[model samples]
Target: MMRVGVISDTHLRSYDRDLAKKLAEHFKDVQMILHAGDITELSVLDMLEAPQVIAVLGNMDGFAAAQSLPAKRELKLEGFQIGLIHGYGPPNGLEERVRREFDDVDAIVFGHSHKPTNYLLNGLLYFNPGSAAGGRGHPKTVGMLTLGDSISGEIIEI
Candidate 1:
């Protein structure tokens, strides 16, 4: 099985050692890491302890982060296709907006609402690990995806 770590909405202007340490512990076993966006700086990505790190540009990202990342991306892993994006607009209906961005994918990973969501709908897996930095009364969280015979997700409070 392949394991992947998912996180978003860090909103950090610089490196956060404490956050990094937490991520290192929570995501220690993952082979890849996905940052759904709102990462204000690129240094934040370095905290993840994974072989592969994929990320997108969120509305709140700074100029350098925006230039280094895409608004959306796709990946093919363990026979499943996955889409990653940083959602936009209001929290309500944020899933629908991100859903419209990709096609023929088994799952969509996104962040923007700072809400943790993991469920299967219409054969698609919609996952949001919430905000790792914690904001707006939401508890800090992250996510894990295990890919084998099928794909499954787990939201981890950090």
Candidate 2:
């Protein structure tokens, strides 16, 4: 199986040692890492130690971070098509907005609402790992996806 670690809305302007430690512990067995955005600084990405790292630029990202990353990304992993986006607007319509963005994806991973979600809708999986920095009154958390013959995921509190 391929294990993937998912995170978003870090919103840290600098490297966070505590976060780094938490990542190491939580994602120790993950083969890849996906950052959904609001990363704010490139240093945050640099601190991650994963075989592969995929990220998108969030609305709150600074010039450097924005310039270095795409606003959206489509990746094929373990026979599944996954769309990664930072998302936009209010939480209510966020899923509809993302659904319209990608035409042929098996799953969509996003963040912006600072809320965790893992649901299957019309045969598509909509996943949001919430805020790793605990924004919007939610507790800090991350996500994990195990892919093989079937795909399954879980939200892990940090």
Candidate 3:
């Protein structure tokens, strides 16, 4: 199985070093890390410390940034087609949006709600890791996905 650490919505002027260190230590065996978006800056990605990091650029990202991040990205992990985006607003019609963006996805991960969630629908697992840096009345946290030809995730509070 491949353990992947997931984080999102870190809009702070500075990242929490302690949290990063702890995550690095606890997820040392993880094969990769993913940041859903609203990162605001490239330094946020540097703090993750995971060898492999997959991320998306949210509305808050500046143009002409060096990171070459995409607004959406589809990745094949193990045997699953996973799609990612930084979803804001209500969940209604959100699935359609994702489907339109990545119709063949087997799983989808998103953020921008600042509320953690995980659900299965139409055989698709939709997940939101919440705000790892904490704000807007949301708990600060991250996530982990243990995958091998399949996918599942656990929300981890930062």
Candidate 4:
């Protein structure tokens, strides 16, 4: 099985020591890391201890982040296709909006609402790790995905 760590909405302007430490401890066993955006600065990605890091550009990202990352991504792991994106607009229809961004994917990982979501919908797993920076009155959080015979997600508060 392959384990993937998921985070989003860090919204940091520079490196944060406390956030980094929390990330390291939470994601230490994962093989890959996925940042769902609002990262704001590239230094946030440096905190991860995972071997592979995949990220997208959030609406709040800085120039360097926008230049280096895509607005959306599709990746396959352990025979499952996953879509990663920084969702836009309001939070109500966020799922439907992001769901249309890709096809034939087993899971969609996204953030924008700053809310933690982990559930199976129409046979697809939609995961949002909330705001790792704990902005907008939400609790600090992250997520984990275990990929083997099926894709599953768990939201972790940090």
lDDT of each: 0.93, 0.92, 0.78, 0.93
**TM-score of every candidate:** 0.98, 0.98, 0.87, 0.97
The regions of model 3 sitting more than 4 angstroms off are 64-67, 90-96
Output the lDDT of residue 130, model 3. 82
**Which regions in candidate 2 have their CA more than 4 angstroms from the true location?**
none
Residue pairs with clashing backbones, model 1:
none
Pairs of residues clashing in candidate 4: none
RMSD of each: 0.7, 0.7, 2.1, 0.8
Query: Could you give candidate 4's per-residue lDDT for residues 1-158 as a string of tens digits?
Result: 99999999998988889989988998989999999999998987888788899999999999999899999999989999999999999989999999999999999999999999999988999999998988778899999999999999999999
Better of 2 and 3 by lDDT: 2
Tens-place lDDT per residue, model 3, 52-153, is 998898766655332688888898888888898887556576655665777888888888777787778788888888887778787888888878766888
lDDT of 4 at 41: 89
Worst 10 residues of 4 by lDDT: 131-140
Task: Give a tens-digit lDDT track for model 2, residues 18-129.
Answer: 8999999999999999999999998899767799999999999999987889999999999999999999999899999999999999899999999999999888999999
Per-residue lDDT tens digits for candidate 1, residues 43-145, read 8888878999999999999899878898999999999999999999998899999999998999999999999999999899999999998887889999999
Residue 52 CA displacement from its true place in model 3, Å: 0.8
When summed lDDT is taken over every stretch of 10 residues in candidate 2, the lowest stretch is 145-154
- For candidate 4, the lDDT comes to 0.93
